[model samples]
Target: MTSRCILQTALLVYFSTTVLAVNYDLLRFQLSSSSVECQNLLLQLNGTTKDCIKDRMNFKFPEEIEKPQQVQKEALLLVTLDIFQKTSDIFRKNLSSTGWNEIIVNNLLEKIHWQIEHLEEILEKIKEEENFTWDDRTLLPLKRYYLRIVRYLKAKVYSICAWKIVRAEMLRSFFFLDKFTNYLPN
Candidate 1:
């Protein structure tokens, strides 16, 4: 009877860990697919718009994330999550005023929002496994980057050309994220 109880307990623990790991993998896969979808949608929107090369802003993506290979996996995940969260907020606040096709812009927002939620789930799992907390200060550079973009848009009065440049920049961001995911440990 004792042996039987021990066997059952061990099996339960094994299956629990297995399921948790599988869930993490599933979330990552879903996030990858969603990221690709976002890129395609952005590509389509960018293609339809006139080039705004001269309207480029002086802001840059955070240098820490520029080289994903050198960053720790947890730091990468946290920073990526922060970027998506900020991007979603910026999109919700600005995209509607851009005079673009409403349906496509809304669809893009929905995908981005979904990605944020998915990243949150992945973050929670990583927190549990790694027992670590991320510093908010790490996101200072990203916040500054977004702040500059927002100020630029406001200064331009959210003109179509300005929005076009922002849209292209977002496309570039998604492209980077898609590539960054490849470097993450599976």
Candidate 2:
């Protein structure tokens, strides 16, 4: 009876860990594919904007995020979560300003919002398993990048051309995220 109890306990632990890992991987895959779809949608919308603005914006993805291999998995995940949250904010704020098709833009926002929620879930699970603190400074670059975009939008008076450039920059971000998903541990 004692041996049977031990066996059952061990099996329970094994299955729980396996299920958690699978959930992480599955969430990563879902977020990756969603990012790709968002990228394509952004591309299509950007193409619709007339190329009348000659001014170029210098905003871009943070270097650390661009090179996912160099950063630790936990930190990468945190940064990604932060970026996604910020991206959702941008989408919410500029939903009507893009001057693009409202339905498609809302669809993209919904997808990103979903990705953000799932990422938070995965991160919370990992945090429970591994106790580690991420530095606030790690997010400085992202904050700076986001600030640049905000400034650009304000400078351009949220014009259609300005939103077009912002959309193009966001496309680059989603492209990097899709590639970064492959780096996540399965």
Candidate 3:
């Protein structure tokens, strides 16, 4: 009958639409995974919590930025994190016994600082645009994660600077000590 055929078609369409609906939970899982991977990569690069201080800074989304731009910025961050994570993994896997050259390490550090700066600029720009009136819970986690990373990177930079200073001072002290010893009676 026509009625039976209509009922079946309706049921099929309903089920198909339901199946095509986005799985928000899965997306959340992916987001969390991406964040975790990023954190892990930083840790591997020597940005441990023991060295990096926890920042209490808060981020507020700006109202001037349209929803689409906000979403685009967040996506850009996610992709960038993913790329860093993958590159780090590859570097670790291919690490050589000779170890990384000092110049290379310094270059990498500079690049990391530049990237962090850019991310912070984006966050600042977002906050300065327009007031975010919607459910901010979705973006809060991402912002927090990013701040944590920035803090870690800062700690790493400070540690490197401190290390270089100490090393140079030690070398200078040794040179002086050697000079003093040489001047003493044989």
- TM-score winner: 2
Model 1 ranges off by over 4 Å: 22-28, 46-51
lDDT of 1 by residue, 17-78 (tens): 87776254565677578778987777667443446667777579777667788777667777
Compared to the true structure, candidate 3 yields what TM-score? 0.31
Q: Is candidate 1 or candidate 3 better by lDDT?
A: 1
RMSD of each: 2.2, 2.0, 19.9
lDDT of 2 by residue, 66-156 (tens): 8889877667777777777877777766546666787788888888888788877877777777666677787889888988888888888
Off by over 4 Å in 3: 47-186
Per-model CA lDDT versus the true structure:
0.75, 0.77, 0.38
- C-alpha lDDT (0 to 100) for residue 85 of candidate 1: 81
Off by over 4 Å in 2: 22-24, 46-50, 95-97
Q: Which residue pairs collide in model 1, if any?
A: none
TM-score between model 2 and native: 0.89
How many residue pairs clash in each candidate at the backbone level?
0, 0, 5
User: Candidates 1 and 2: which is better by TM-score?
Assistant: 2
Q: What is the alpha-carbon lDDT for the whole of candidate 2?
A: 0.77
